[model samples]
Target: MDGGLMLAESLPRTSSFATDRQRGGAAFVERWTNARAGVIGFLTGRGYSSCSIAERIDDRPETVRRMWTLWDLSAYGHDGRAPQVVVPLSQRDRAHLAGAAATAGLTIEAYCEQILVNSIRR
Candidate 1:
């Protein structure tokens, strides 16, 4: 055999890691776009940027932006600036929710949104 080549050996295949890196680069672009949209939307609504929200929530700017995408609210004006809270409902509220859901032939969440929309319309 000469220094030129070896016919017995085939070239090595591409590494999955390399392919994944390429894919990750593209995915990063997509994720960044989503984050940008979310941050811009939040900024428009609350007069703040990703960093402001992150500081408010005790998270990093990028992390907060990622959360926006994860929550499926990366689009503009997706969610309000209200802080989310869990309230233990009284039996009365439960009954009211059930009745409203049944009346609308919708799930409890849908009924709640409907109620919220109506309340906000005022």
Candidate 2:
């Protein structure tokens, strides 16, 4: 098991979605620190779905999904400067790419972007 999963398992589980912001306007959302984002990315690499992550962190599944996307974008240097591009691959190739990305603790998009960046830098 990843160390992050172990630590996440020990987090206090909450049934309510209420927070300080709900009670008062003191806070709105939990700050996404580098460590927190990395943990989410790690869990994602382990094939945990967004719902699974949301349950673990006691947040909405949608929030987890958004955060995961944001983390991927930031980590891969995708500054939204370039428009999104789609690369269609065969089923076999897609599966292979996904497997490789999972092994490297990254999403398929992030893994592909990383490869592109590295190739450009070479």
Candidate 3:
């Protein structure tokens, strides 16, 4: 045990262990860390697949799946969320949508949905 402890202590620690204050940017980290669960819940409630959530959050699907498992979100469909509508777009339009989504901190699917909904209002 002592030898194992000594070997572990000898290894270098990563910045991941750094505190929010130590990172000199607590706002982003704190906000996301606190809200991630709620965000995932919202997406799950909306019946979004893990892959879709991963695409929106710019994370790997496996990571999202692991999170879902850890969070005990298995109550949802095992096959994942149902498929959403698909809108064909040109390369230029796709780029524009991507930029808009990034600026709005939303995924392309979400941004497009919001746009479609707003258009219905008009």
Candidate 4:
């Protein structure tokens, strides 16, 4: 583990498997780190479960779920949280989200649902 997070330096950097990242900036590094975390988690001991996918990708169960859809993993459904705080996004962000979900082979909703369920058992 690198700095309390898993490393996925070996994952593909090619055009086909590339994720949505900034040209070069702090945000780029942050997103790159998150992607690596998710990849490492999945390749190591997490698989599609919460700690690996969710923990690695978004650092939050809800956010990870959202990532699943962004990468196209499939939706895992909602966690039924109260107050339903809404996070706003622009058109480009939504496209990026969809790309991420597609890459993960999950949908935003189902991916999150799956993470919550797996986390419960861990």
Model 1 over residues 12-98: C-alpha lDDT tens digits?
222122222234655552233544444445443544556665554344778765666776763554454542223347789888888
The clash tally of candidate 2 reads 0
Estimate, for each residue in 65-114, the C-alpha lDDT of model 3 and write its tens digit.
78877766555444354534445578998999999999999999789889
- Which candidate would rank higher by lDDT, 2 or 3? 2
Q: Write the per-residue lDDT of candidate 4 for residues 1-122, one digit (tens) a residue.
A: 54344344433333212464665665543354554545633543323444444443445555655655566543333332221223346789767877877788998645555656699989
- Per lDDT, the best of the predicted structures is 2
- Stretches of candidate 3 above 4 Å error? 1-32, 75-122
**All candidates in order of TM-score, best leading:** 3, 2, 1, 4
Top model by TM-score, which number? 3
Alpha-carbon local distance difference test for all models = 0.53, 0.64, 0.61, 0.48
> How does residue 95 of candidate 4 score in lDDT?
79
Candidate 2 residue runs with Cα over 4 Å from true position? 1-30, 73-122
Candidate 2 lDDT at 114 equals: 97
lDDT of 2 by residue, 69-103 (tens): 75575576443335344565789999999999999
Give the C-alpha miss distance for residue 17 in model 1, angstroms.
34
Model 3, residue pairs in steric clash = none
Model 3's TM-score against the true structure: 0.38
Per-residue error for 16 in candidate 3, Å, reads: 15
Candidate 4: where is the Cα deviation over 4 Å?
1-29, 33-48, 55-58, 75-122
